[model samples]
Target: MRAAGRAAPTSDPAADASDLRVIGRVAPHLWPPGDREARARVVAALAFLLLAKFATVATPVAFKYAVDGLNDAAADPRAVLLSLPVWLVLAYGAARLASVGFNQLRDAVFARVGQRALRSLALSTFRHVHALSLRYHLGRKTGGLSRIIERGVKGVDFLLRFLLFSIGPLALELAMVAVIFLVVFDLRYFAVIVLTIGLYVWFTFKVTEWRVKIREKMNAEDTDANQKAVDSLLNFETVKYFGAERREADRYDRAMAGYEAAAVRTATSLAGLNAGQALIITAGLVAVMAMAAQGVLQGRLTVGDFVMVNAYMIQITLPLNFLGTVYREIRQALVDMRAMFGLLDQPPEVRDAPGAAPLRVGAGAVRFEHVDFGYDADR
Candidate 1:
C-alpha cells in the first residue's frame, strides 16, 4: 500500500515534455477541428483583440495632440478652452472607451470557447480515470488525483485566456511602441526600450524558473496534506475503532508544516523577483524620461512629445510588470497539466486480444481450464 502524505508516481516522459508541447495538446480542444461555430467565435475574438490594441495604441497619440494644441493656443485662453484641443481631448476619451469596450467584447465572445475546452478536457480526464484498472485506483490517493485534475482544468482555462489575450497583445503593443519610438524619437530611445524589455524578460524567466521548483514542492505538500485529510475522513469509522485520531492529526499537521515552509520560500523568492523587475523598469523609465527632457530643452521635441513618450513607456512597462506573474503561472499550469496528462498516458493492465469475438452462450456451463491467475505473478 502507498504511504500517506506521499504523491503517486506519474510517467516521467509525459512530465518531462516542454510547456509548448503541453500547450499543443490543449490547442485542439480550444480550436477543435471541423467545428465551424467555435472557429468563428475564435476569429471574432481575435478581431476584437486587434481592435482593442489599435485603440490602446492610439490613445496616447490623441493625448499628445491635445497637449500640443493647448500649448499652441496658450496665448488665447478661449481657443485653448474651445478649439482643436477640445476635440482631441474628446478623441482621447473615445479611444480609451473603445479600448475597454473592445476588450470586454473579446472576453464575451471568447468565453464560450474557453468553457468548451475546459469542459471537454475535464470530461475526457474523468472518463480516463474511470477506465483505469482497480489496481491503479487502489494504488493512488483519491484526494491527490482529484487535486491534479482540478488544477489541470483550472490551468487550461487560464492558459486559454492569457495565451491568446495577454501575451499576444503585449507583443503587438510592444512592436507598435518600438516603431513609434524609432520614427518619432531617436535610435537611442528605441535602444533603451528594447534593452530594458530584453533584460526584464530574461530576469523574470530565470527567477520564475527557480520559483517553479519551489512552487512544485509546495504543490506536492498541498497534495499530501489533502490526501491525508481525505483518507482520515473517509475512514473515520476505522480511526474511531482504532482510536487513531491523534495519529491522523499528527500526520496532517506534518504535511501542513511542509507546505507552510515551501509556501514561505515561494513568497520570499517572489519578493526578490518583483524587486528586481521594479528596479529594471524604474531605471529604464528614468533613462527614457531624461532623454525626453533633453530633447525638449534642445527644441528637438515638445512637451507633448515628452508626455507621449512617457505614456508609451508606461503602456509597455505596465503589462511587463505583470509579465513575470503571467509567465510563472503559465509554467506552473503546464506542470499541473503534465501530471494530469500522465494519468491518461497510463495503459490499462488488462485487455482482450485484438479482434476477440464476443462470448455467446445458449446453454453454457462455466469451466476453468488450465487457470493461471495471480494478483502478483511473482508470488
Candidate 2:
C-alpha cells in the first residue's frame, strides 16, 4: 500500500483486471497502490490467509461431529475412544499445518511491504521537514515534532497489520460462531455472548479514552521537564556559578510529582475497567454452564454438547477481549494518525516549477542571492 510513488499506466484492460484481482485477493482493499512486485506478494499472502481462516472455522465442526459419533457409540467404550483420537488428530494437525504455512507467507509479504512503507514515510517526512521556512520550525518544539512523527509511523504499521490480519478474520469468526450457536443450540446463548461483548467493549473505550487524554498531558509535561533538565546539565558550570542547583532540583521535583499523580490516576481507572470486564466474562461463563447443565438434565444435550458449548464460549470471549483492546488502540491511533498526516500535508516552501527542466550537467552554474540569516536579536 505505498501509494506515494508513481505507478505505471496500464493500457491493457485485461492486465489491469489481473492486477486488481491480485490486490483484492491479497491485501483485500486495505492499502492503496503499491509496487508491482509487492502487489503480487500481497495477492499470494491473501489467498493463503483466506484458506487458513476457513481451516480455523472448520476445526470446531470437526469436533462437533466427532462428539456426535462418540455419543452414538456409547455402548462400545473402545470404539468411542478410538474415534476421539482420530478426529482430534485430524483437526489439530490440519490447523497447525495451515498456521505454519500462513506464518511463512505472512513474513515474506511483510518484509517487502513493510520496507517500502517505511521508506516512503521517512522520505516524505524528511523532505517536508527540510522544506519548511525557518520561522515555522522555530515556532515549534523540535523534540515534540520528532516524537509526533515517531508515534505516527508506528501507528500506520499497527493499523495496517490489524485491519487486514486480526480485525477482519476475527470479525468473520465471531459472526459465524454466533450463527452456529443460534442454529445448533439455543439463541439465548448468542444473546448472552453478544451482551457481554457489548458491555466489555463499552468499558474498554470509556476507560482507555480517559487514560489516553491524561497520558498525553503527562507526556507533554514530562517532555518539557526533560528538556529543562538537559538544558541545566549542559550548562552545569553556569548553574553552579549562579547558585541555582537547588532551584533546578526543586523544578525537577515538581515535574516528577505531577507525573506520578497522573500515573496513579490512569492506573486506578484501568484497574476499575479490568474488574468490570472480569465480572462480565465470569457471569457469561456461569450462565452458559448453567444452560448446559439444564440441557443435560433434560436429555436435550449430551456430555459432548456441554464440552462444545464451553469451548465455543471460550473462543467467543477470547476474541471479544481482543476486540475491546483493538478498539481502544484504534481510537488512539486515529488521533496519532491525524497529527502525522497533518505534518505530511505541509506544502514545501520551494518546489520545482511545473515544466521545469533539469539542469544539464557541466552546463549549469551555481549562484547565491543576497541571503541574510539570524538566530536571535542578540546575535
Candidate 3:
C-alpha cells in the first residue's frame, strides 16, 4: 500500500496532538516539498492566481467600453471600431495567459505536495507499524489502516491546494463586490449582498455538518460489513467445511442491503446540499441584479458599472460555492489529522530513562528477576 521510505515511528494520535513538540505540530508538514527552486515555482504560481483573478474581472470592464463605443458610432465610427478589436484581443489574450499560468501552477503544486505527503505517510506508517507492539497489529486490520493513510494524505493535498489558491481569490472577490457597490452604488445595496451571502454560508454549514455526521456513520457501518465479507473470503475452507455457503451469502446480502440504504441517504443529503446552494446563489444574483438595475435607472450606475456588478456577482457565487466545498474538505482533513494524531499518542512499550549512563562493554549475562506477564482478552 505504501512505497519504500524511512520515517520515525508513529506516536499515539492523542499524544502527538497534545505533545509540546514545538516544531512538528506548528508546521503542518504539508507544504510543498521542493527545495529553493520549488519554492520559487510555488511563488510564481501564487502570482498567477492574482493575475488570473484580475484578468477575469477586467474582461467585463473591457466589454463595457466595447458596448458603449459600438452604441456611439456617430461620435467616431472608425476610432471606436479600431479600439474594439484591440480591446477584445487584449482581454482574450489576458484570459488565455491566466488560464495557462494557473494550470501550470496547479499541477506543479499538487505534484510536489502529493509526492511529499505520500512519501511521508509511507515512511511514517512503516516505521510506526514496527514501533507498535505486535499486539496492536494482531488486533487491527492492516488493510484498513493502510487505506486510511492513503486517503488521509490525499485529503491533506486537497486542503493545501484549495486553501492556498481558491480561498484567497474567493475572499478577495467578495470584498471586491462590496467595494464596487460602495464606490459606485449605495451602501445599503452592498450591505444587502453581504448579509445575504453570510446567511447563505451559515445555512450551508449547518446543513453540511448534519450531512457529514450521517455520512460518517454510514461509512463506518459499510466498513464493518466489508470487514465481515473479507473475513469470510479468507476463511473459505472453513466456510465450505461447515457447508455454510447459503448462510454466508445471506449475511453478505444483508450487509450489502444496509450499505445500499446508507448510500441512498448520503446521496439524498448531497442532492439537498446542491439544491440549497443553487437557491442561495440564485437569490443573491437576483438581489444584486435588481440593485444594479435600480442604480442604472437612477443614473448613478453606468452600463459598464452594471456589467461590472454582474461579473462581481458571478465571481462571488463561484467562490462561495467553492468555499463551501473547501470548507467540507478541510473539515474532513482535520478529522483525518486528528486520527493521525491519535495514533501518534499511543506510547511506546519500551522507552529509555530520562537520563541514563551509557552501557559498558562486558560479558553478556541473561537475567529475569521476578518476571510477570498478562494478557487481556478484550484487548
RMSD (Å) per prediction: 5.5, 9.1, 7.4
For residues 42-151, could you state the per-residue lDDT of candidate 1 as single tens digits?
99999999999999999999999999999999999976667999899999999999999999999999999999999999999998898889888878888889999999
Best by TM-score: 1
Least accurate stretch of 10 residues (summed lDDT) in model 1? 1-10
Q: Write the per-residue lDDT of candidate 2 for residues 74-167, one digit (tens) a residue.
A: 7787775566646665775677577667756776776677656656776777778888877678677766677778766776666667766777
Clashes of 3: 15
How do these models rank on lDDT, best leading?
Answer: 1, 2, 3
Better of 1 and 3 by lDDT: 1
lDDT of 3 by residue, 71-150 (tens): 55547756855766456656756765775577566666556644665567657756765788867767777545655665
lDDT agreement with native, every candidate: 0.85, 0.68, 0.65
lDDT of 3: 0.65
Winner by lDDT: 1
Ranking 1 against 2 by lDDT, winner: 1
Give lDDT: candidate 3, residue 344. 61
